[model samples]
Target: MTNSWSYSSTDNLWKPPATIIRSLINCVSKNGNLLINVCPDGNGIVPEQAVETMREVGAWMKKNGESIYGAGAADYPTPEWGRYTQKGETLYAHVTDQPIGNISLRGLRGRVREGRLVATNTDVLICEYWNPEVQTLDGPEDIFFNFARPTAWTYPLPDESATVVAFRLNDDEGTRTERQRLDEVRMRI
Candidate 1:
């Protein structure tokens, strides 16, 4: 995805998690390219907003590029957290919004081998859910917990604008879901 693409900050007023990063992430996840425009100022220098946005994107990508570099669509729905990108055995969850509590993956039961917060490389626990969701993040011991146990331990965000959750899928085949671009998503063309 190409960034620092066209944005009308004057009239359009680009919003954050910045449109460029958001577009690049979502497009790459669907196997599409994002062409970022570098709109220059009067002096032919990029504006502070654009520069800062690129820096933020670069910072996030440095750690999480593994998820987006060779990622494709997974057999999953558009998550509230943001988007899903699959690279080989790993599924990258790009969480744009700051989640309040543990966000449950509706059909993600036993699908993940394990998870890590891309920003901090911190481990996030996963579990299979039910009336009393079975959380297996800690270890096998936690799996045997009685009914009414927390599904899984939640991960703490490390002050990132957009954090990616890298999930190593149990199956190498990855998700069966086909690559379908989100209707709301648009490429820079």
Candidate 2:
């Protein structure tokens, strides 16, 4: 719990701008909530930086709050690009790190209804193509553009907190992709 005034004791613990947002995303991904602490002087007035930070957070919440409020941990393999939050039949993908190319939701081929970015202007390409999960003879797996006729997508990242890719989870897909996040969102590492 911290506020605008970076405590004199520990300055490394907190930072402004998207600190709250980043913390909120991280905590929410792990099924936790962020309790912020804001301190004021003798007067009841909140600090200016605190207020500004809140305004920014509020702006982000206005468009993407649906993915956070009343949401829970997504029952799927964590994506390297970002995190996941599920509410009811909707799976919200909170993309923090930017992706390179095609974003693939492996098991979700035909179970998807409609994808609404609802935040940024980036083009979201949801096509029926399966980018085969490659397995090289070396050691680590190379996950990249699987431009097949199955599952592959691409959504650019946002400037603020995260870029939410909301997918309507159908009843049929419930058993298959349970908590299984979208496969690969980027082509390159």
Predicted model with the maximum TM-score: 2
Off-target runs (Cα >4 Å) in candidate 2 are: 1-14, 120-123, 129-156, 173-189
Give TM-scores for every candidate, taking all chains together and pairing residue i with residue i: 0.65, 0.66
Index of the highest-lDDT prediction? 2
**Local error of candidate 2 at residue 145 (angstroms):** 11
In candidate 2, what are the lDDT values of residues 11-118, reduced to their tens digit? Answer: 334356566777787788788998777665466666566678888888988878888899888877677777778888888877777665556564455456556675
Q: Put down candidate 1 lDDT per residue, 69-136, tens digits, no spaces.
A: 77888778788768888877787888777554455565664465667877677766443221223332
Candidate 1 regions off by >4 Å?
1-17, 130-156, 172-189
lDDT of each: 0.58, 0.60
Question: Candidate 2 lDDT (Cα, whole model)?
Answer: 0.60
